[model samples]
Target: MGKNFTYLLGMLITIIIGTILYFNLCSDCIAGSSNNEVEQVVTEQATAPEPEPTSYPFAIANGDFDYSAEDNFNFDLSSANLRLPVSEKVDFGIYKLKDYLAENAGKVINITGLYSSKEANNTAFPNLGLARANDVKNYLVKLGIPSSQTNTFGQLKDELLPLDGVLLGPVNFNLADKAEDESETIAALLEKIKTNPLIVYFETGEASINLSAEQRQKVADISQYLDKVDGAKCLVIGHTDNTGSRATNISLAKDRADFVKSYLVRNGILENTIESSSKGPDSPIATNDTEEGRALNRRVEVTLN
Candidate 1:
């Protein structure tokens, strides 16, 4: 009986040990499952973020679009972008948009828009308003294209609507939805002149050169500036106040342009690079009846030819 009692105690101890081992093994399995669940949650959190969208500042929308910037990353909008629409509403000559494009060595420009005519000589067919959208297109591609960054657009027609005074003022200065994010060499030089024309002018009207002088320097500076351009030729146009008679004004305007051209030639500028003209009192910048207007009128202007 003692032996049997001892055997029973041993059996009980063995059962207890087996039960404890089973419980420990079950606990380890549960811990492993919990660890795997935590790892999966961390991995899921890491990979589920939002992505950003791509954008183009001067994005081409319409089918008729062409743009050029030597290094597009550093492009100026003047010659860095071009767009022209294929529409009958466009005029070939009056708007002079083609001339403007040619002058800038084929600036990248968009030719599709409600155009107005500022043609020096009105063409046989005039546009509805003063703008010539189609002429700009054909001129860019057909006539004298320096670059290939021009295009036409339909969506922009909606965005640039209703030409009111205040809105028109800001958009006139080659303004874009966003600033160009690149550095274009030609556009850079053009922009410098557009923004700060004084850097190329003398004080008022003296037969001297001053890169630092304002107003008159635009003429002399242009002569020096042409060298930096690839294939630049300019029309040096002269004008005068109505204070003088038409004949006298015309003569004075011619003299003024000649004087400028002579100075440029003296300074080693090629003579063929510039063409001279005299508008006299006909194309007064302001109402010449006023002193300020007269002064403004008695000046020379350089147009891209």
Candidate 2:
């Protein structure tokens, strides 16, 4: 009986040892598998590629017309100057926009040019923003768009991000139909001209004349008015400061008046529609005592009849 009991006890001990060894080996294998999976996930996460930067395309859109391009007009930092991009796509889009405008006679485009306070105003305008807007307007006008159908203004922005010191798409366009009465619009324009007559200043001995952006805009408005009203005449009067003899001053004033008349004729106005005369030293808007006043007096005043 003692020998049988010993044999059963030894068999039971051996069975328990085998069971423990099998469980330990399985645990090691499971741990190794889990580690391999974690390493693969870490590698994938570390080697992932970064996303590219977002791009903003320039666009011009109206009710049913929409055009977009990768590039548009660009300007240098702190400059009122801009140049159109030399891309076929951009040119095609602009031509399309022009055609759309021509089809809609009542549609007027308002160009709002953006500028930062940090930019310097080097143009002969009230601000850099306005100068930039006018530049764009002139470009459109040269492309056969009526200056009367387009208006320009400036907007001040707190911040602007530029690429390589160039501001892309610095202007925004808004096309709106003119809703005011025609007669009333003409009356308002005439009143504005009366209140703020277009004046051209001449240097001491400079014969060649260069008009500022503001002056050019005034000329454009005047041209539009003349086209609208029949038999309306433009009067260009020249005046001079009291510097030389009375005869010499009178002759200089007359020359200046003729010069202005020629300028108007060159800009699409008929010579017969313009009347030029010299006031000499007789009419002085400013005192002839100081250089500043004299400079102001040496000008040609343009008015409409």
Candidate 3:
């Protein structure tokens, strides 16, 4: 009985050993399967696609063309209003506006807003619409804008202030005393000269008035006033120094007289009333021997028609 029991015990031990070996192999096989699964994962990862980078509408900065504002990437530049697409709005100062307008010449553009003098920065800006417009026209002509086509009209004329009171300092001339219409005043002023009430002169003529801005502006104001006066007419006369031949000097003097007449005529003053005559170097306001005297002798006289 003892021998049979011992033999059974040995068989039991072998069975136990076989069970342990089977479990060890099964556990090791499952762990090995997970390792193989890792290989499949790595293969899929190697074949996977990559994400694309951001792009832009136009050619972004490549160092060829520079940018005005730094850090373009931070802002949402998709909106048209927010992003400055062109160089149109760029300004170094207020004069650039005039420069731009002048460069464009006759091209009609909108000029808006009231630019005030004494604002420190915008003080030098023209206060009068016509003056500003004229300045713009002149500027554009200088900028190569064809002078023929250039015409400017102000949208907001009332907003402008008088330049004389501020930037130009106080206006000395009596703008009111001068006739409102230029043609009429030019006529009256010339006629006044015939009686010698209003003195006329060359660079240093017998006219006591200095050819300063005060004097010229007064003339201009009178010219404007004459344009407003009723029954206003322009009378222009020509004069010359006695130093030259009488016939030649008379002809030359007439030409000189006509030149002033022509300026008013071209600028909308009636030519019919603006009669031209040359007093040969015969009318000597001063002696013809000296250069100064000769200069004084070259004169144009105007009278009402």
Reference-based lDDT, each prediction: 0.46, 0.76, 0.43
Show model 2 residue runs off by greater than 4 Å.
1-57, 84-86, 198-237, 250-278, 285-296, 300-305
User: TM-score of the candidate numbered 3?
Assistant: 0.34
Cα lDDT of model 1 by residue, 187-248, tens digit: 56555565544311223456654332243345434433454464777667788878858998
Off by over 4 Å in 1: 1-183, 191-211, 214-225, 228-230
Which one is best on lDDT?
2
Error of 2 at 34 (Å): 43
lDDT of 2 by residue, 210-258 (tens): 7677876677567557645667778898999999988888889989989
Error of 1 at 123 (Å): 42
lDDT of 1: 0.46
Count clashing residue pairs per candidate.
37, 0, 17
* TM value for model 2: 0.58
Clashes of 3: 17
* Candidate with more favorable, higher lDDT: 1 or 3: 1
Q: Model 3, 218: alpha-carbon shift in Å?
A: 4.3
